[model samples]
Target: TFLDAVSRARPEIGDYPFTTIHPNVGVVQTKDGRSFILADLPGLIEGASTGKGLGHQFLKHIERCRVILHVIDMGSSEGRDPLEDYEIINNELKDYQMRLLERPQIVVANKMDLDNAKENLERFKKKYPDVEVFETTTIIHEGLDPVLRKAADLLATTPTFPIMDDEGTESSVLYTFEEKRPEIEVTQVEDHVWQVTGTKIERVFNINKLNTEEDFYLFADRMRYMGIDAALREAGCMDGDTVQLCGFEFEFIEN
Candidate 1:
């Protein structure tokens, strides 16, 4: 009752091209016949916690991964600072989900062929003496077997889910999608001019870049066409009313 999925592809699917990177999520059955889910999350950078650079997206993918494999670019010729990069990514992961801090971690020092990599590995070992590490160079297929073997061994030992207390029950949270219509308040600002504000209108304004007359007209048209005009009209907005966004105020002339 044991199985394994092997991929000989240069880079596994759904991964960004080049720089020896791959993102994968799959179930692995151990030699002992136990199965568990695993995820290969993308390396993160500083400001990832704030969703600065696909950090939030990447973090969300690993939310279900009980274990983490942090692969570092050991060679780092293109100015990829490993230590700081490691710290920044870890911080982002911790920030996104606190539970990730408790997950078991392993570090993979990749690209050991470069001269700087040996020096960096020495520094990394000295700094993080306790971290389990595996060095590999994908170009020549060197040191990969040991790394894969260790990963498989670690996975075999790691549990699928966090151990729960005897008395602790799961969360009583239930989610449902109920399409509720937007509640707009009809406020008479001065005269026939009414302020039309809601999540629907605000979201439309956010994505619309009014760089040209055509774009501006398109924005207005979208707002009006999305029944926003009808709602405003029903809310007592006259044809000659003044419409004000967060900063820019426009004359609400229905053409």
Candidate 2:
């Protein structure tokens, strides 16, 4: 409902949990003619960072987000402690490999119209003294404008985080003299263990969400067309040699 107030992306609003099965991306325009993309990702339950509940799915959607609008149910409508909910989410983010906690965060004290909401908000404010909290009741569209404005303000100043991986992000850049460098690179991580990595490959892996044999074959076809197989051979890879791509390992084959 909050997203509906800011943008037209009226995702499934309900009283029960997990109304959003997939993410809904919407463009938000503030009053000052400024705009930004807002992604209404699925709710994160406990153990989300560990691939439990819609864990990785919800977390992955926020990778490109510059600011996180954390909405808390101040009324404890679901019988949860609002302050404890914040800590639980923060712990999940910290546990995730992406360092999600490092992003700029704005807290939204939602359900302000409900009883005990004001009391919960007071406790939250005291606990998170340095954090910015916005009082709001998303159902009626109250106090949502400030969130949009603040999000836009933060986006205008924050820089894009550097993309990297422990597996050969350095070798991904060959430092060639040509104007167009290779979009990908192959690195030998260890004996008979080759790693295919680059900015493009990582982005592709994140976007594709390959989960079946057909998807795997399609990705393999793409690698072949992109000369990844040839690069592996050039790097002294042989049949049955291990090739790692985005942490997944496979055996090289010579045809």
Candidate 3:
């Protein structure tokens, strides 16, 4: 019902480019002159934490949100158990990021107009008694005002949290040493031709524009320092052999 809420708040929402596949953001102004921006994120499925089915993308957006509105379909119209759906979605959220569970959540029990919706909602409440739930049927736009008001009230009290924390202390100097790995791979493609390819080597080659001979020699010296020269020699690369790095080729000269 997030889309419904947005439509109600902004009647011109139809003219805007709105899609459910990506996050849809809209601003709502209450009768009391309070404004809140609501984000309608993509539906999360089971196994989202371990990069399952766009779960990471959906969960990443929730990290910045101070309040979460978990809209559940109370009516089992899609052949899904409302209680099971709630558990699955919550489990995914908790698994993806435990911190997400720490945020204040308002349960939106949608499709209340359905026959079995009220019964399902009661069961859901009995299971999660501490949770705050609001009922609404988006089709007729019923019971949305209370939900919006409650969300605004909760937002007032909720504080923003950082996505990540700094590792170093105020006075401490933290030196991180990334394990030195072979940046260039020397492979004898032919008798006198060697092919060099690796992520780091390609990035270095592109970033440093080696225009002059001094620059080229400096780049070659860097390659030597990185043990690329030694690697090529060990791989049976001879003097005058063509050493191909990325798209650039140079004749090898042994020191």
RMSD of each: 15.9, 15.0, 17.6
Residue pairs in candidate 1 whose N, alpha carbon or C atoms collide under 3 angstroms: none
TM per candidate comes to 0.52, 0.61, 0.59
Cα lDDT for residue 226, model 3? 74
- Among all windows of ten consecutive residues in candidate 2, which has the lowest summed lDDT? 13-22
lDDT of 3 by residue, 1-255 (tens): 466454443312111111122355678777687878888766665566766433565578889899998889898765568899789888987887647888888899998999999899989888889987999987887888888888889899988977863444275676979676565677887667677767677667666544344555567667767777788889998876766554334567765
Candidate 1 per-residue lDDT over residues 118-211, each given as its tens digit: 9888888888898878887766666655555656777667666533323545668879795764544445666644555555665666676553
Give the poorly placed runs of model 3, Cα more than 4 Å off: 7-20, 165-255
TM-score, predicted candidate 3 vs. hidden true structure: 0.59
Could you tell which candidate, 2 or 3, scores higher by TM-score? 2
lDDT of 3: 0.71
Decoy 2 TM-score against native: 0.61
How many clashing pairs per prediction, in order? Answer: 0, 0, 0
Indicate which candidate wins on TM-score.
2
Alpha-carbon lDDT of model 2: 0.72
Lowest lDDT 10-residue stretch of candidate 3:
11-20
Ranking by TM-score: 2, 3, 1
